[model samples]
Target chain A: MTNISRRDLLKSSAVTAAGATAGLTGIASASNHGKHNHSKSKRVVIVGGGIGGATAAQYLKKMDSDIDVTLIEANKNYHTCFMSNEVIGGVRPMDSIEFNYDKLAEKGIKVVFGSVINIDPDKQRVITKDNKVFSYDRAIVSPGIDFKYDEIEGYSKEVSETSIPHAWKAGPQTAMLLKQLQEMKDGGTFVIVTPPNPFRCPPGPYERASLVAAYFKKHKPNSKVVILDPKEKFSKFGLFMDGWKRHYGYGTDKSIITWIGKEAGGTVSKVDVATKTVTAEAGEFKADVLNIIPPQKAGPIAFETDLVGDLDWCSVDHKTFESTIHKNIHVIGDASIASPMPKSGYSANSQAKVCAAAIASSLNGVPMPDPSWVNTCYSIIAPKDGVSVAMVYAYKDGKIIKVKGSGGLTGPYNAEDRKREELYAHSWFNNITADIFG
Target chain B: MKQTKLILIGSALLASSTFINLAHATVIDRATILANTCAGCHGPNGISNGPLTPSIAGLPKNYISESMYDFATGKRPSTVMQRIAKGYTDADIKALSDYFSKLPKKATEPKKTNNHHGHNH
Candidate 1:
């Protein structure tokens, strides 16, 4: 061998070291070294134990036994967003929607009872409000949705402290609304203002209205409910209308429910808090009780972590549910920008499974399997009368897209099918709660 | 003549898979086949060096299949065992399941090594 400079020797040694490292990966000898570069097992930390986060933890554990995973949430219990409407309508108690994380902890997962206040993607670290800093190889954020208080005038979180309540997040406020409605007189009007598009649970408000009407017919027959909505039509509206007609004498002078769409100026222009009257595009509507579902975005933790973009939703790689902004950090649920997939608990649960599978693959340095998701949203026009629309979704052309020919809407306002759907809805809730929590 | 040619192509393809199976990764389903390879690190009778490696004796056959299938399907990620299992056929997995199920649970002393990773159940 010819004599080489010391500096040259150092450079050659560095190259050799890198080559040796590459060879251990099992794909270093291939011509296209850049195509696939596998790494070692990674530690994945997921924030939020709601439907999405919990489901992801289960899936990831099922996928990989070696990956170290930790799930963090502010609350130990999660109230199901899908069924929370029934809680507010007094059909189901708040306990009906609540679920614990004990099942997840039993599955060899480390469940952290703390609020994630900050996420530094560059460092791959998550900082809790209590100052517990955790470094992770990958992280998933699914904090769910929050109401935009400013969009509705004089309707702030503080305002809801006493007089008016949004009850959008679906906890104490939900029970408060139901209690307020129960105290209203027989002939008094209960005004509900539906917010604009891009809100949680697209079918939520209608379900709330239907359940509340069911209660009114039983307790106070003369009480009337008016739904001022921004959208002209809604999911399962035809079914809801049919149920309303059958149960509450809708579409006549003796109707117990009145739903005015944007065309009829149903969308509220402003809320005058002192008078307890809402000024809509139609006119000022006075009420004994007001339930305003304001425009919503991702929850506060998601915004605090810088996971949201210009659209007030987290940007994610549709295929893996991994965040596009923060490397190795994934976002799912209502907070994630997954188009064609509505922000429903079922969608969140489904996305969680796909995310779990992907996380396992990335952590193990293996090939990620193709992912597909299923979502079914069930609503009750009455306790025993229900309707739902179910769909299967898949990623196509680099984004989450609905799988055509896989799902269809409920049939045109049928009574028998609606009744069957209600039974199925309750069963679906139990199965989903068990699937995510149990 | 074209039909004959197509038939020849299909027959060749079928014959090649048979040849590949025999040579590429021969599946060992018989007790004798697994007794030699797996028993070296694991126990001859399905016991292990300790809790460091899981005791596979008397495990459910379906659970064994699912565990092996998960390893094969990339659903359950592993490091060393993943590569070790890459060669196991479905039949071999079933056979291993049978062998492990028939064996009794026995324990042995843990081997001292450089890596100190261990979780006590």
Candidate 2:
């Protein structure tokens, strides 16, 4: 009840005034040390060291080196989901996509490898699983997406781990799925179950299907890849259909890749793990390798922090990314609902920078600068063939709107252009990882 | 570094000279924020690591603005730049050109000793 009034106050105040209040709070806390004490460096604690959290940490330091930043992540290393599809398709090693916080630490960000148990908005502190309490003037949570395992019958987290692989989080699950695909019979089917909309990486399922088909075509010519979708269409639909038709005999009797949209009874209701069968409205599919990507919501940490109140995702201010539900707490990455901007790693990284700038300015009692964001998601369809969709965004009329005529899909598939996009996609991975963890 | 010293001297000169760029100072800061988004693929300071994504750091101011103008106007052939370029205003392009052209082209690649995961398309 009090938080509603606080949110109203924040909404009514000028941008700098909200930050000025935070600045005053910093001074008030620091002056508690002694009567003659000087103001301490403002402390920012970030939970979840994914693309958004990592980028915010690094950029906050860059904006003002005097600010003390501490980043807490559960895992010592991060396995990026962006290019993990390449690993699943056997185009690159898993180690290539794996990154650590060593570079972020080198930038003077305190990288703590521990699970965050709680973020107390009232106390302005973050509590870890081991009872470690970190006080902060501001906090950012970038907890990525979590799956609703119960959405499908006979499928849960345990089943996803051991039997059917989601491989959405891009770690051992990826390796497991890859091993199954490799060991599969040459004429067998690799079934991929697609999730609904508002999920991380909108085009991810199609990309996975493309790469797997490529793998099957090379090593097991008689094998096929089947995608059962819950939606009528997907990201870059035309581009993907073209690529599939050109390379995988899609729409032909000998097609290696078959896409069943919702209209075609692609909505799956159950999976028989014991028999490796997927039951969709279209029909039942028996497969040698099954990849089930279940529906998703914000990660557990977001829910644990009470950031998402009766919603699947966190609500944030378009300009500052500060939570609309809570004060002084910002959420970015896949956990926050940023429509018009797909939940891609590039969008997370871009949002992180804007969020960081807002936090930095707010802490210093300065007006938040105007914000701009851009996202370019590149997906490799097959070797030497990649496609991309890009957009530039601006904050207008209290909402994030895409700049008209600014972004588009990769033009008509020229081999040279496709080849170049593939290269850029790899380079993008290199540069973005470097920007975040490096 | 020499760059910092030059920047300091430049600021001192700007303070003494006509306040022509005073109005542009905030615009420059906004442009810097806009430009930071490019580092995801272009690398920090616009010095790219990948062969295809060219380094735009330290290029001539005129050249940078001209190229961006071309990209925005569809005169230049680019895979993603045209879409990206059309997003910025002419003022943003000018400010970005001025900001990036002044920085050194070189940036330290993140320390990676063992993992060399560069794969060809």
Cα error of candidate 2 at position A163, Å: 1.6
Q: What is the TM-score of chain A alone in each candidate?
A: 0.89, 0.91
Model 2 alpha-carbon drift over 4 Å, by segment: A1-41, B1-28, B107-121
lDDT tens digits, residue span A1-438, model 2 = 123333233333433332452322221211112123222336899999999999999898787665679999999988999999999899999899999999889879999989998899998889999988887778999999999988889899999889899999988889899999989989999999999988999989899999999998999999999999999989999999999999999999999999999999999999898998989999999988999999999999889988999999999999989998889899999999888888999999999999988887766555576889989999989999989999999999888999987998989989877987888898888888888887
Question: Per-residue lDDT tens digits of candidate 1, residues A227-317?
Answer: 9999999887777888788878899999889999999999886888987898888999998889888888898877887877666888899
Give the true-structure RMSD of model 1: 15.9
Per-prediction DockQ: 0.02, 0.26
Badly placed stretches (over 4 Å) of model 1 are A1-38, A413-415, B1-121
Residue A61 in model 2: shift from native, Å?
0.6
The estimated TM-scores of all candidates read 0.72, 0.87
DockQ of candidate 2 (2 decimals): 0.26
- Candidate 1 lDDT over B7-96, as tens digits, reads 112334433331111111111123322332343223334454432334466778787677776755556643223334544546667876
